[model samples]
Target: MSAATDRTATLYRMVMPQHTCPFGLKAKALLEREGYTVDDHWLKTREETDAFKAENGVRTTPQTFIAGERVGGYDDLRRHFGKPVADPKAVTYKPVIAIFAMAALMALAASWAAFGTLAPVRAGEWFIAIAMCLLAVQKLRDVESFSNMFLGYDLLAQRWVPYAYVYPFAEAAAGVLMISGALMWVSIPLAFVIGTIGAVSVFKAVYVDKRELKCACVGGDSNVPLGFVSLTENLMMVAMAIWMLRYVF
Candidate 1:
């Protein structure tokens, strides 16, 4: 590669006390990380920034130029390097994994406080309850979004529609009741019914139909895959319902 093409890039970034642009800092860091010698240009004043934008016929700061061609901003720079830029609408397990991690931690803490020990059985109960509640909270954030995503794979929701709306509330109610060890009659049945439906639906969608899709178990907005994690969630609920049923009956 030629020395100029191999080593250099031009970066224009905003650097002011009141309006220091974060993307500008990220762009500089990215360039350095990727071993590029950056010709760093700072827009120190608002007028200077405005003038730069007008001159370039662009409206955003922290613009990059490689080989004297405008490469836009931070996200654009990432693309230029073939890095994965996060898409907000994309499906991912990040949200679901985060909730499960937090739920387990909360369960451990609660178990310790209540039992003065991590009682294995009780810890399992607490973990499932907290996980259910946390997942329900995500779904409740935007029920309509959750329902729409849910209908894509959920058998009952696709047919009944209203079941999608009711699912979150039922999950939350079952979770809360299980936590308190109260109203097993209500919680057990609720858990069993939903868990059965969800398990069957997920099995058919992924294993039977061979359709790849997002799981609404975490929330409508999540990118959690419709597979093992989802199946496990349903199975946990089903097991909890049966376990709790033994106590009630």
Candidate 2:
């Protein structure tokens, strides 16, 4: 190894080793698990902690400096988990509120369909239309990173694939048809099937055995909720899709 490479072997860390500090312990344990000896300073003195934070931009302990780069706090440590671990299903995953609303609207629109419950929001499937629009907003602004510490366009060096093109476009197109109110019969079902597949696939991919892949889901937020997060999320989508499809077809 060249001198530059050899120097890389030493992982730098600074922490006020204490029981009360979550960030401090998390940062330390994570590094130790990764096989790097922590070079930490117990900053009991106010002057020392202040100087460290001022110099390093870390008011939080244990503050981590890896290879000369400052990674802040414990949540920031999740950045190391990598993007490859991203659940593919999350690509289409949406929150429960959005999913339920879409289904409710689609049901309300249809008189002939068995589900009159979805009609309130089903004006030509406007719910899907607006969702696409909002997603477009999120995609443009890159809200995914709003929740992520490390993964961002910066990580990919600016290369990115937006869901608008990858999946939302399809969702939007299908939604438009349903909301147009012309095909309450056709568009509703289309939405359901498409949404279901998207939801179910991602739910499985996230919870099931999958490889490490960076999450490209939302601009960058990788702080995921624990426990079969995939299942409930995907299930809702699948159910919404089925419900929509039921009326449209």
Candidate 3:
């Protein structure tokens, strides 16, 4: 209603993404009517959408906030006037724990599941997983990566190239070294890196693993869910990194 209020600041909202979801459109219309600016995250990917919900604690479409206060969705936005929003409690970012945890977990799993130790594996899976594990260990240990668990939103990892391009090759290489009786010492470190990278690749799913995003690390044939599994996998990698530190320099 007042010029000072209009000039103070604007609110932002997020919409549950669909093929051109109307909820977002309606919310935008309402904001405009109230002389408020509307920002849209589009809710395209689960990571983005989940982050939105986590930050706001709301899950429905057309989530709204003025300045900093959550004003609810479309209906809620229509009710609020152009006003500076009350700031919510601050959210902290913690990536080190996530990264190391993921590495440790994946290392453990790769040592066993991927390498026929923890859970039983088919002959093919065993052969493949062993090699995969060996290289994973090596990759995890020595790669010159500065990213935390999720690769810090790298486009390469988001597109699955790190996994498809880097991981499979590392896994296959580790597998060969083991089957062919190559240098165990060299192979151990190499496998550690491989496992670490593999884990990071999985955690990087937070970037591109949308609801419809299919995984590419397992030759289009994986049995893992998208969200929590990706996170847990990262924690596994972090653990593995710690494990490998005992062996690798």
Candidate 4:
């Protein structure tokens, strides 16, 4: 087929009164983004949609045709154009990277707004504190799931299941206190003890035992791997605790 012919796509999608197919919209957008001249066709009724599906031997709408050949659904079209389709179960650091990046930005913004300049030292502290709060929020959303995942590698959590449930709250408390530079007595110990325990637990699990597991750092449902990133989180908490101690002593 000619390149010009390949650039012309025929799309059949469902646009019902009650609901429009999201995948259909996605397919159209994707085709346009890839420089295709899309011949958009909508099946406005269930009967028409069913008839089209039956005639074409396809179970779903958002079907795309290129050069007289079917390219299937949205996912298939993506693959046809050599695009990477997302896999939910795949291990990735994207969540942690996003959290840290946003935390850094928040810290810098806060520093600039409050002090009228980018206070590097203050921003650094805020970054860690904010990151802790964000990570705690992820765990707090589904404590049960987080605890279950935590139990897999945390030595303390393995021995005492309740510690898993308490972990998120402790982290959050420490983070809030750290942010305010108040309640050092509570925050210091909480951060220190938990951080030390977590560091040890992660080390033994990943390095000592050489176990491969998903990290509960982002939450229980995440696909983030248990390794360097998890270890770094614990170490940062420990470091924050020590950093706060300087002010007390």
Candidate 5:
């Protein structure tokens, strides 16, 4: 094939009434982005799709062909163009980092709006409170999953399974009350109790026992490794509890 002919490619993808293949659309877009002229073909019926798959010796749709050479699916096309493929099992701190960064910004914004300036102490308090609320939201999304994961390293949760279910709610309640500067009696004690337990659990599990595990702080489905980040979360809670204690007396 000539160099110009090589720039032209053929794509066969599923586009049925009930379901259009998402990867097929992605593959076409990628080919276009890479400056390829796609001769797009659609397998409109199940029989046609099955026939095509059998003919091509393949099991999936959204197949690409360049200069009579089959290039597989969307991921294959990406690799052909030297792009990185996503791995679902990859460990990452992105979720926790995003939560913490957003919390910091929100805290500053709230401080400015309420006090007419970015009050450092107030922002700091709000930062921790907002972080807790956000983290709780993650766990609350899948309470059962969070509880199951929490039972892995949390001493209290391991002993009393019910605490696993209650932990997120307690964290959220403490955060909300701390933010409002109301009911320190409830929030302070709750934060302190949970925080102390969490810190000890994390330290013993990671530092002393040295067992590798995934953190449930972000959520049960998280890839964040159980370590300093989880420890920091508990420490922050404990610190916030102590700071808020001044108001109780």
Candidate 6:
């Protein structure tokens, strides 16, 4: 056998009838990927698992050992190998990505129903409209929270607090109106103004000030960072407004 394949690692993981630990399986996979031969030890029962933890004085299972030294849990194993382990509290773009993905699917469905085909241009239009409506819904769910977060960066909202409160309603109204391709006079201008302001706010807060902040786009409870996703949301609205304006004129 090759020296890489001969490198040995040890792991202890729970594999009970009621609960099977996934981390243990992952750790074994990771060890194999790194060319280590894993001596996997399974704790088959709850009592056995508890007893193992107690014996080792460790609270969690899927404990790893390398060269007769403890390497800790799954995250610890990752850290040992210099792999990136994500912090649970860290802000990410996952929520926004999910929202956009769902919005795109919805747009595709709508386009298919209306045109009997997956019209790319029409789908794009519906995507922006649907995305705006969904984002507005998230804001409307907790206006107070949205406003408080919004004030952190929004130029107008910081200067005039009432704009923060009105923002969600305007977004919702514009989105709804745009979806039906009606009330261009009101929706177009509202989308344009808010989109411009939002893009500027995100840019200033994230780039200019170098401030790490949560995006208000997915609501106050979101961990979505205030950056590309937020800017994309605003840019979508701006593009939609311009596209709709051209149709009106």
Q: Give the per-residue lDDT of model 2 (tens digit) for 1-249.
A: 455432232222343445345556666777677666676656666567778778866556666666666656556655763413335456333543454465445445553374544445443344445444443344335444533421221212224444324444444455556445456555455556545654444544445545334333333443333225434433544454565655644
- For residues 1-249, write the lDDT of model 1, one tens digit per residue: 698676789999999878889999999999999999999999999999999999999999899998878889999999999999998877677877898899889998998999899888888898999999999999999999999999999999899999999999999999999999988889999999999999999999999999999999877877788999999999999999998977876
Candidate 5's displacement at residue 223, Å, is: 1.4
Model 4 spans with C-alpha error above 4 angstroms: 1-6, 45-51
Off by over 4 Å in 5: none
Angstrom error at residue 248, model 6: 0.7
Stretches of candidate 3 off by over 4 Å are 1-163, 176-181, 207-212, 221-223, 228-249
| Between candidates 2 and 6, the lDDT winner | 6
* Candidate 1, poorest ten consecutive residues by summed lDDT: 87-96
Ranking by lDDT: 5, 4, 1, 6, 3, 2
- In candidate 6, the residue pairs with backbone N, CA or C atoms under 3 Å apart (3 or more residues apart, or in different chains) clash, namely none
Q: How does model 3 score by TM-score?
A: 0.28
Ranking by TM-score: 4, 5, 1, 6, 2, 3
The alpha-carbon deviation from the true structure for residue 65 of candidate 6, after best TM-score superposition, in angstroms, is: 20
| TM-score: the better of candidates 1 and 6 | 1
Question: What would the TM-score be for candidate 1 when compared with the true structure?
Answer: 0.78
The residue-level lDDT of candidate 3 at 199 comes to 56
User: Which lDDT values do the candidates have, in the order given?
Assistant: 0.92, 0.48, 0.48, 0.95, 0.96, 0.90
**Candidate 5 residue-wise lDDT, 15-71, digit = tens:** 999989999999999999999999999999999999999999999999999989999
Candidate 6 residues 55-132, lDDT tens each? Answer: 999999899988888999999999999999998898778878888899999999999999999999889888998889
Instruction: Name the runs in model 1 displaced over 4 angstroms.
Output: 1-51, 64-72, 76-84, 87-90
